[model samples]
Target: MKRLKLLVTLAKKGAIGEKVKITLRELADELGISPQSVLRLLDEMEKEGLVSKEVLGRKTYVEIDHEGLAFLESLCDAISEALYNGVIIGEVISGIGEGAYYVKQYAHLIREYLGFDPYLGTLNIRVLFPKTVFDALCGVRPVVLPGFTKDGRTFGDVKAYRIRINDIEGAIVVPSRTVHPPRIAEIIAPVYLREALNLKDGSRITLRVVKG
Candidate 1:
């Protein structure tokens, strides 16, 4: 697994089947080993049908094979599954009042991706030390809604992660991009979360975010 991960780090330009220009010395530096050690690892991987390498002059081009990609996919899935099943506890808070507008505008896309029509607004949560939760959530694949031009303005993509709040189905919504702060997350559910959970500002709640 460590060697496979090292090969994945070496293929930085793209995924399997995409050409990447990398050198054994660079790989050794990245893997914290000798160039000869990298060569041995590459030989082992090539024998196992995981990678393909070519030598041209002093440069080496590397690419991962289908089998390698499949293995990586499985590894990612396992990691995501392990990390995805966690609890997030936070205090309910008031948003900037923009949730209604965006949620209403993107209702169709949200429903299409999340399989449920969302309530008109969001439930804001102020988390405590949310770095781990944020990283784990970001590690998994998110349901993305493509941006579109509306009212002479272009709205960016939105990402949603299926979640459950006290056993009620919901999702965490990140508007625009993946570069969000770890302090807060906006949640949307099929019903009004505030009313459903009898929540108010300063109320603490627990959420379960799942990947599969």
Candidate 2:
């Protein structure tokens, strides 16, 4: 698991150079394992394409490939969401913040100006991808909007995103902005939900309650 974690971390960061790279010997020393053992693990990962290996003269260079990246990106999200719902995020950022915008699209946010260590975990966000945003986008593409407001406004000016999200669980509607499981669905941007309801464009700003 240690070697796998190290490999994935290095690969995801593209920690390679023109000369090719191998596991850092310092890393092996710290992990209390010989470089040979690390090599064996890399060999196994290479067979799976989770790691790619190149034999150059007397050295073996290994790095993460696309498959490994997908896995880690998924991991980053799972861990982040778990933290978000588990004793981490202090207050319900009920106003517009990052989650309401892009994580739903790029699966990553790219801002570094915020004072706090920007939550670097993945959002457990899911988009039902409604007809509006999907239809309007150039490729009929689905995107997560980051600029949504907390009091049920929206991610952006165009609330036509087909992105519907659960605002309720089992039998009850979620109370706005406290803490709840990602599964419970209380804390959602109102705009995205509204679009999914096929609203009249500028109708009664009521949250479109979906049948959970």
Candidate 3:
């Protein structure tokens, strides 16, 4: 799994199509191993038909074979499905005009915890079975945004659950720190989710909350 992860990281960083040109030293540095170790690993991978590489003048041009890519894709699919699978159907709606301000204020923590800088506002959705889902989230660990002091007042801590809506990775933001009804949920993503997902108010979408 670590070897495969290294290959995927290389592909993302240096690959164009199926081929990537990276040095043994570079790969070793990225993987935090010695060049000799990386060469041994690559030799093993090559023997197993996971990668093919040719050394040319201190640079190694590597190619992940079709079999290797297929294997990686299958692993990715399984992991994604496992990480995101609490089915909740919801309809988009407008918020109470506080989402933008709060999101802007909390943008730094969102990026740190969620791996994306969310847009200025959130996409509010009126969820079906809101109580069941909310209660489930309450029982699980969440990505916590610690409360901070701003403008002489203290902002309360917020909790988030990893979710993917319409295949876009985001989170179900439960700010129980504030007064919010159980019927509505807010989603935050890197992009303006409604525009990115081509959605409008009244459009129904699915939220897959991550299993605890």
Q: Which candidate wins on TM-score? A: 1
User: Could you tell me every candidate's TM-score relative to the true structure?
Assistant: 0.58, 0.38, 0.56
By lDDT, who's the top model here? 1
Better of 1 and 2 by TM-score: 1
The window of 10 residues in a row where model 2 has the poorest summed lDDT is 84-93
Clashing pairs in 1: none
Local distance difference test, each candidate: 0.81, 0.40, 0.78
User: Mind giving the per-residue lDDT tens digits that candidate 3 earns over 1-212?
Assistant: 66976778666865535566777787888888898998898889889887888888877888886667778889877875554346778789998889988898889999988899888989988876444456436445789988898899877888888887766888878775655677778888888987898999999988877765
Error of 2 at 85 (Å): 2.6
In candidate 1 the C-alpha lDDT for residue 17 amounts to 64
Selected candidate, larger TM-score, 1 vs 3: 1
lDDT of 2 by residue, 32-98 (tens): 6887777777777778777677877776566677777777779877765443321111111233344
Candidate 2 lDDT for residue 65: 74
Error of 3 at 135 (Å): 4.1
Candidate 3, pairs of clashing residues: none
lDDT of 1: 0.81
Candidate 1: regions farther than 4 A off: 1-84, 177-180
Total clashing pairs for each candidate: 0, 15, 0
